[model samples]
Every structure is written in C-alpha cells, then in structure tokens.
Target: MDLATLMSKGLVGPLTAPPAREASFPYGLDKHGLHEIAEAAYGDRAAATGFLLAAAPRPPRRTILLWVTQASTARDMGRVPEAALREATGGKARRLSLVTRHATDALWAVEEAVVSGVVSHVIAEVDSADFTATRRLTLASERHGVPVTLLLPHICEGATAATTRWRVGPQPSAPNRYDPRAPGHARWRVHLERCRAAPALVGQAFDLEWNDETLSLNMVPGMVTGSPAPGEAPPHPGFPNRRTG
Candidate 1:
C-alpha cells in the first residue's frame, strides 16, 4: 500500500509482507526502514546532524556512512563529519568505516553497497533524490536485509521510495528536572509525513525527547494533548492553554 495514503488514514503496519518486521527499536530510530531528517530549527542543520548521529546504530559488523557532497565542491561534507561522529559516539567512530564522495559517485556506491550484503546499515547524505533511485535502493536494501537512511537537505520534497518520511522540527526547550537553569540535550516534534511500513503511526506527530545517557528516545505524550496533572500547566507552546477560569 502507498505510505502517504495509509499514513493519512492512520493504518500503519509493516511495509513489506506480513513478517511483522521491527519498525523502531528502543531508540527513536526506525528499524529495517527509512526515515527523513529535516531542519529542527530554520537553519539548524547541525542540530539535525547531531540528532541523526545520536540515533545512528553502530553494529558489530559495519555501519556505512556515504557522505555525499555537491558535484563540484572540494569542501568536506560536514553533515556527519569525523569530529562530530566521534563526539556523538564518544570517540568510537573507529568502529564505523567512512566513505566520502561527490553526489554522482555516492549514488552509484550506495547501490553497490546495497547489493554487496557486507554492511549492516547504509546512511547517505545527498543533495537530492528521485523516486526511482529511492525505490531502487529500497528494494535492494530490503532484499539484502540492510536498512538505508537518506539524509537530504532542506529541499527534500516530492515522491520517494522510503518507508517513512518525517519532517523533524525543533521544539520548545525540555524543562530540565534536575537542572532548572540548563537546557536538556534536545527535543524534536516529528511529523510522520509518510509511513509505508507502520501506517498507523503516520500523521502521528510524536513529541520525542532524546536521552543522551541511555542513547534512546521516548514518546512524550502530553505535549500534543492537553492532558496534564491537576493544577499543572500544559507543556509546550502548541498545546492548548490549560488556564480555564
């Protein structure tokens, strides 16, 4: 079934045939699936990169990062740079081998890796992608039982071969229970723009709070709904005002 339509109707499940593949792990990252990451804030690409790095899985086998840059630029693709990855993984990026290339070569390399069956996960940061390329990768990744994640820039729109497309935008600060004066790591309001695998989760904008300690994300339910403790204020700016006289 088409992901966009299924997600719109709230009928979410596994994308492929009924094997009940895992959609998401304990961490907020999807499993055996594809998800989109957009700017949390207007231009906070670094935050987006951090979110992905935090969520990236480091398998014992291999985690391939195909960092794609402009066709002509000699500059580095700083989205998932070595330094940032090192910080995110606590200096364990040595576990993950890296590949940097221009978009043209990167696309071909991704296809090659999908068919090789040697890597556990493939992550690509590309300038743009069409449905055909996405579909090709999707099929190959599924056949190889390897998950693929596409990291596109702000202009990531139109059709895709991904299982779910999420518009991850920044949210208001998460009140630090322990340190009232300090901001928590980060929080995101994820709009499940499309969900081919688990369509029931589509249109279900999950307010996710990431815990750096556990390296996992949990669904913060109260942010969307007005339900809160008695005499307590509703959290988040988008929630309705609880101050009924």
Candidate 2:
C-alpha cells in the first residue's frame, strides 16, 4: 500500500496504557487520609490502640499529635502510656491529649485539629462514627494534608466514608529469643474489613508483630506458641489462632 493511502486509512491509533496503582500494606493509612481501626472484640481496644501506634507513620521532629478520647473510651481502655508513645514515635513527636464528654465532641475535636493545620497527626478514640462524620473528617484530612486515625469499639458497623477500616485483635506474643519466660514482640491479627485505596485487599487478614527495638511493624507467616521449658525443645512456628467473624 502507498504511504499516503495507509495514513489516510488510519490503520493505527496512538498507543495508550493505564497507569499502575501503588499499594501499601495498610493501604493509605500512613499517608494523608482518614482511616479507622476498630476492635474485633469487646476487650480488643488495647490491641487496636497498639496497632495504631505501631503502624501510624512517624511525624517530623517537634511536631504535635492531637490525641482525642471520648470519656467512655478513656474510662474503659485507659490512656496510652508515655513510655509506649515514646517508643512508638521514637520520642521525636509530642502528644496533646483531649478528653471529650461525648463521641460527637470527640469527632468534632478531631476534625478541628485537622483543619487547624497545627498537628502533624491525629488519633481519636470514640464509640463509633457514622458515614457523615467520617466523610467530614476525610474531607478535612485531605484538605489539610494530615492523617487521622480513629479507634472504634467492636460495635462499629454499617456505612463509613473512611479510606480503610481495620479490625484488630491481640495475637499470641512471639516467643522471646533471649529469655524464653519473658514476653516477646507484641503481635496482632489485623483484618481489612473495608479499603477504598485497595478494595481487592478487603477481607484479607495479616499477622503482624511490633518490634520495639527496630521500631517497625512486620508481617509474619506464622506465630510461635508459648516459650519452651529449660530443657524442652523450642516450639515451631504454626498458624495463628483463627477467629470466626
């Protein structure tokens, strides 16, 4: 065929390809967004809190972190220890604690903190949040470029506008390498109930260990059982205990 004829025929169009999507373990939680971590059980609030502290992205030095807690949640779960916060953030960040009388007030404080543009991060412990409340927080977080993490009770359900929702519970602690009798790294079972950033990852569960020494959250294939006796052989790694939904 003549070149002019082929050109006129429009044999081919410009090649095009869709952009590849980037994925993170906790989805966009470490980034600038509004995410929720809910307890898998009545007493799993502590586990959810620990997971938040371990998994949240560390902020810049001397930055402020506004931690807002509802009165009920504070009374039930207690406040996070200073030493734990120091280890979690490497003592580079400061925390400003706020106690709200009600969930609505707590949510309001969280959104205000995000919009104020003063704190580097925000963590709020509330009874629950509906779609409208979460939507407001998400918008504020996006507009201000600050990340907000919500710690919700096990009863949290139904619609939510958060970028991700994680159901967290305590897992068997990893065996201590040096002292078998001592507690090892803290572990948790994290289930992704909802994810806007990576919907495909929803319903997936992970076994995570928080290594204080390394200050990192790591996923493990299996968890070791209880420590061995003085002369007993070391226990082998096996599947973690599974919880029914």
Candidate 3:
C-alpha cells in the first residue's frame, strides 16, 4: 500500500513539519514539540539525563513536570534524587513521576500527560521507540503546546519524528578552583544528530558546562586540559579520578 494509504489506516505514522519561525540553538529547542536525547555510549545515560535536566526549559510558575520512565531504564539508571532535581532546576521544579512496565506504557503515559493539560512539560525515558511512536508524540505535543523530551538508550537509532535528536556523553570536568583534588561542575559533549529547526546544524557538536552556581548551561571553547588554573594545585594522586555530577 502507498504511504498515505497506510497512514490513513493507522498502519504508519503521519509525518508533519514544525511551525514556521526563526529558531536558534538551545532556546529554540523549547518550542512546542517532541525532542529526543540519547546516550552516546553505554553508561552515558547519566550524562544524557544531566543534559536534559540542566537544559530543559523552565516551566511557568505553579505547573508541575511529568516524568515517565519504563521499567528497564529505571532499574538500570535509577531515579533522580529529589536533592539533585532541586539543585539542577534551582528549586523551581515540582515534578510527578510515573514508572511503567513497558516502553509502550511509557509512551502512552507521555501522550496522556501532554493531552491532559495539567503538566507544563513531559519527560520520558524508554528502552526504545520507533518512528511511528515518536510521530504520535510530536503531534500531541505540538497540538497541546506542551513540550516533550525523550531520553533513549545508546542503542536507539534509525528514523524518528522528533524535532531534534541529541547524543550526549560525559566529559572531564574543569578543575576545581577551591580544591584541585575535587571535581568541579559537570561537563558534556553534545552532538546534534538531527535538527528540524536548524537543518544546517544537524551534525554540529558542542562542549558544554553546567554551572550550578549560576544555574546556567554554557558552551566552552574546548575540552578542559589537565593543567590546573592559576593559583590552584595539581590534582592529588591519592584521590580516584571520576566523572563529575
């Protein structure tokens, strides 16, 4: 059958374009639609989660966020702590979480949350989603004016109807100025695999740092070097080197 015929019969997802408007990186992502953030590799889900939390648009006052997670993803990555959410969102986030037994259930929950008109935003972590599922989410988010973000595993691939797709990986954090032995603010290497808002920027990559003090995410020049900043001592050998939060 033809593509249009399949869509009409609910055998395939219908593809749609985002609203026409000038859009820029970062902020433009806040537009009403579905976006996907996937891990660059195994164990990079933490980095992807961190990026989503730090970069997601702040909801208007009084509206809470809806977070949906599939069982497998939740068991592997664990839930975000209340303190971490407070720190990441600068204490402005009021969140409701839901755990589903399967990816289909998680996707259903996301769509329901979007159409419910109760949540300011929706975030979901699922094991996988095909193009049809993503397209449904995109349509719901755009129609309801509620933004949705999907956190996917590294194995996620192939076509998707999301407005944008980002692959995030952890990077060595900048040196700690207060104490060189300690880890500083978290950093991530974000690669834009696909972008409907800015097609030309599809393959661009960015090195970003999350500043907890300023509650902002900023792009840095390049990867941080091993040398410490002026007046700071080198990292101590006794302390184990690990990824920063």
Candidate 4:
C-alpha cells in the first residue's frame, strides 16, 4: 500500500500531514485550452489581449485554434483580435483560419475540429450557450482526444463541456522578495468553479504569483500540516537530579 494509506491505517510511525493543495493556472494560456481571454477587470480589452499575447506557447505544428467572435461586440471580446492573437503566438496565429459566425456556428466548429483529427486545439468565444451544445462538445472532445476551451462573457450561463471552469480576475501585485517595495509583474486569483479532472481540488482557491523574469507562476504554499505525535518514547539513560516528596 501507499504511504498515505499506511499512515491512515496507523501502521507507520510518526508522519507529517500532507500539504494543502492549491489550484493554480501555471500552464500558461494554453494550459486550459483557452485561446481567448476576457477583460473582466480594468474594462479594457487591451489588457487581456496583451496578457495572452505575452503567454502563448510555441511548439511543433499540428494544433488548430478556432477563434469565434461576435460581430456586434464593442470591445472585440468575441474572438481574440487577429492582431493580438498573432502577437501572442509570435505570428503563428497568422496561419489560423477564422470561421466568423454566430455563437452557434462557433460551437459547431469546435466539434468539427475535434472529429477532424487535424486540429489539436479548439477555442470558442460565445455569448450564450445551452446544455445540449456543451454536452455534445464534451463527448466530442473526449472521443477525439482534442482539447476545447470556451471563453464566455460576464453573463455566461447554461452547461459547458470544459473539464474545468475558472473565474480569473486580477489581484494586487505581490511584493518583490528581493526589494520588498518593488512591485511584481502581475497576479491573478483563479477560482475553480468546476474541475472534472481532479474533484478533490474543487472549490479550492489559489493565490498565484507570476514571475516576469521566468514568465511562470509559482504557487504560494499555504496551511502546512504539523507532524504527528510519536506513539512511544525514545530510549534514554538520563535520570532526574531531584525528587519530589
């Protein structure tokens, strides 16, 4: 049996409790198959766009990002703007062919990519969705082994096919460990609204700290459990110097 199971059974001696698991989005923008970012904070589309542009991954070809955007969006939240998407992917986005359509069209495209076996990833930004669409996409994504990420507006409702749903928001910058007063690049609070991959981590909140130098997020560990008490005393030769009456 594993160490954890043995400890729980009282078979092992003293043991320390496991660390609390914290939810973090360290896989960059692509970790969750998200190709579009929402401007939930600052109300500026540029901020979200800029963040994504600076975080897109680079690797071998064979991945497809289906950007679906609304034609009526004022801030261009429907799909990652071509310019911004291009910048984020370091011009690789230029090869992406956008299928401009309504929310329903976008959802259908995701399913198509999943079954086609040509696209490795699919991203859809929609206004409103229902349970049926999400259900179909979920099955398609699983069967085809392709990752599909949905970017919804503030009023997103209904069901979803995503493995995890997150509410990402900007957080106050963490103080620099080296300079104490200097401000860090940026920080975010990612609330795991849903997680099918790891149910045990559901409802867990993570305080993510971003490092600009390494362009990565290092999770801040919290609530470390103390060591358990020993069952028996250790052997010793010492004796009391004084005795009570």
Candidate 5:
C-alpha cells in the first residue's frame, strides 16, 4: 500500500510533509536556513554583519563558526573588533576567519562549511553573489540543516535564491536615557526585501533594535516628532579590563 494508504489503515503514524521554511521568530533574522543582508551604497555593512552575528541564535556547544570575507571588505571595512564579537556572542561561540581574494572563493568557502557539518554556522561577507551561487548555498543549507548568512554590498543586485534579503542601513538611535548626548542602543532601518517564508512581509520597513543586555532583536516603532525613539536603552560604556589606579 502507498504511504498514505498505510497511514489511513493506522499501519504508521500520521505522515506529514515538512514545512517549506523554518518557523521564523519575531523578526526575519532568526530564520534557521540561509539569510542574506545587502547594504545600501556607503552603508554601514559592518554594523549589519555584526548585528547578524550578535542576533544569530546561539549554536550548540562544541561547534565553531566559519567567517568568510573578501580582501577588499577586510581592507575597507576592517574586521570586527574581538571585544565587540565577544560581547555579541556572550563569550560562548568561537569563530574561524577566512579571507579570500575573490568573492567567488569566499562564497565557495561558505558552501563548503555549510555542508561540512563541522561548524555550527557559517557567515560570509562578500561584495556580490549571483543567483546560481546563492541557489547552491540554499540547497546546501537545507540538506545539512545548517544556517548560513551572507553580507553583501549595495552593488549586489538582481535575483537571488536566498531565503530572505534584508536591506540594512544605519538609523538615528534612540535618545539616551542616562546621558542624552550619548548614543543609545544600536538601531537600524531595515527593509525586508524578499522572503521565501513570508512573501507578504516584503516591502515593509521596520525600525529594529539590538538589545545587547538580552542579546535579542526587536521591532520598534519608528521615530516621531518630539518623542524618544522606541527601544531606547539606558546609557552605559564598555567595561574596563583593569581596576583604575
């Protein structure tokens, strides 16, 4: 008998097809499958990358992260500060960095890591990727059940096979609660450009906040006249390493 017939006869537990996409969290960033972040011209690509790293669901223990970047990105944007990464991950996850001269090589490394099953996650920063490249990465991610995030520049245009595409740019942070002059919590003006999971959500823009204290990403209301922006955090500075003399 066919599997459906067997199920009707109670010979097997009820069979159901898997979901086309993973269950998404509040914002689209937590998507378990592949994700892509494309920055606008002169956009703060580093911040978007860092947010993805910080916002990613903490991976299981004993697996490290694979980070691939193009040489130009490294030279122009510079690498993420170790202190910043440590804070973003809550000091639990470790990362392996791989710098490639070409965007293709960087993308290749991302795919290899996704299918290797050695690392828990793969995050790549490249200038651009074509549809074929993204499609391959998506298949590998689904097959391996691993998550991969690609950070691209504004130049990265055209169609793609990624699960979601977010156009991220810096936005004015909320007014500081403690020190009004100081910058408040990290905020971004985000556009959910494309989504295979929730296509209807596309075209809408969201003001997002990265809460470092809780290490969570939240969608807050946009700024309004004469009012503190949403998702403002208490002002604080980086902790010192040693006691003051």
Candidate 6:
C-alpha cells in the first residue's frame, strides 16, 4: 500500500468530530450532566440552592431526587425548609436529604447516586470540589444519564469540568401589590459563569423571578416594580380616619 493510497483510504490525521450531544435533560443538558451552583462574596447561597431546586430538570412524576449536603453547611445555611422546597418545586419532587460530615463523603455519595440510575437527580451542597473530583462526577453523570449538581461556597475558584457554573445572588424583592412593606416574589441575579453546552450565554447575567404559583423561572429583561407612592398613606395616631364614611 502506498502512502497516497493509505491517505486516500483515510488513515486520518485527526479523528472525525463526535456527533452533537442529544437533548436529554431540560435547559440544554444531555441525558447525564454536571451543573455547579456557587455563591458569590455576598450572594444568597440558599437562593442558589432554591434556584437549583426550582430550575433543575424535572425527571418524572414518581422519580426520586437525592440531596446531599455537608453537616457544616447545614449548620451555617440551614436546610431548605419544607415550605420553601414545596413552594419552589410545587411539591412535585420527592427529595431524600442526607448530611455528611465531610465534603469528600458528600461528593462520593453524589457520584454513587448518579451511577445508580435509580435516582433521577442529585444535588450535593459541599464546601468545595477540585477539578479532578468534579471531572469524575461529570463522567459518571454523563454515563448513567443522571443529572448531578454541586452547590459550593463562594470561595470555590479555578477550573471545573461541570456542564455549567452559576453564581447566584439575591436581589431585592419586587414591590408588593397589596402591601408596600411586604415582599412579593423571590428574585435572583444569576450569572452564568460557564456553560459547556451554550457557550454563547456564558458570562451572561439573568434577572430571574421564581413564581411559586406556577413553579416556573421566568427571565425578566429588567426589574418589574412599581412605585409605592400610589399605596403610601400617612399613619393616623388618634383614630381610623383614613377612608371610612
């Protein structure tokens, strides 16, 4: 066989590009994937967790979701209360919460759950995960067709192999319709630090509102608010003399 003939037969200088990843999970993730949610310097980490809980791919009606968090994190941030969880997910997900003493153990449990295939989703709240550990989790998640998320603190830096990395911060609540002093809907300022699938949206910022009634995350171009002037009223010290006839 001649060199030219071998070349014609496609001995190949570089391999062909792999097929485009199929859409298996919501938000442009393949069947199996790794997503990371990290807090900012003064951002709301619980909001980050709620964002994940509210926005992560919904597996099915009856599938189980795993939540693994470090003991220290549970102490600091406190667990996502049942009311919040219910409000976020519309009481759809059946979550099994587990607390681990160390981050490593929590990570291990995340990997095992991803590989198990029984659980549909896994969310682990650990202090940090190095690139290597995250890479392993990524591989396992991709293989088993399970989606896993790592919720790390603000200090986590450097590179990671996760599908996407988001920095979540709590924004001021939208103005209340009935009461000016009361909070309206939950709002978040989400920064898409990294996105393996949609690199175009990477580094983009999104102002999101979590509508618990609909259990949906809506993207608002700008803040939706109203001035409190229309609802303002001077307090009366003597009697209820505002509007009664």
Q: Name the candidate that leads on TM-score.
A: 3
- Model 1 spans with C-alpha error above 4 angstroms: 1-30, 40-42, 58-77, 81-83, 86-102, 177-179, 223-245
Q: Model 6 over residues 1-245: C-alpha lDDT tens digits?
A: 88787567643223233324532223433245788888876447878886787677765476788999899999998888777766665567788999999999999999888877789888899988999888888777766678888888988888998888888888776666778768777788888888787777777888887777787777765635322244456685888657867
C-alpha RMSD in Å of predicted model 2 compared with the true structure: 12.3
The positional error of residue 42 in candidate 1, measured at the CA in angstroms, is 4.3
Q: How close is candidate 1 to the true structure, as a TM-score?
A: 0.68
Global lDDT of each candidate: 0.60, 0.84, 0.84, 0.53, 0.75, 0.76
Model 4, span 1-245: residue lDDT tens: 99899668644434132212224342323443322344454444434433443444443554456544445443454345566454445455433555555777777767787779676566665665576677666556555555566655655534564556655566556654555445555665555666655667766766555565554655654431122222344455588557779
Q: How does each model score on TM-score? A: 0.68, 0.82, 0.84, 0.60, 0.80, 0.80
User: What CA RMSD would you report for each candidate?
Assistant: 11.0, 12.3, 4.9, 20.6, 9.2, 8.1
Q: After superposition, how far is residue 186 of candidate 6 from its true place, in Å?
A: 0.9
lDDT of 5: 0.75
lDDT of 1 by residue, 117-192 (tens): 6665567666677886777676666655666677666667888877766667666556666666566657776677
Worst ten in a row by lDDT for model 1: 225-234
Better of 3 and 6 by lDDT: 3
**Candidate 6, residue 12: how far the Cα is off, in Å:** 21
Q: How accurate is candidate 1 locally (lDDT)?
A: 0.60
RMSD of 6: 8.1
TM-score for candidate 5, residues paired by index: 0.80
- List candidate 6 stretches off by more than 4 Å: 1-26, 29-31, 223-233, 236-245
lDDT of 6: 0.76
* Candidate 2 lDDT tens digits, 66-160: 99999998888899988889989889889999999989999999988998999999999988888989988877787677889999999999999
Off by over 4 Å in 2: 1-22, 223-245
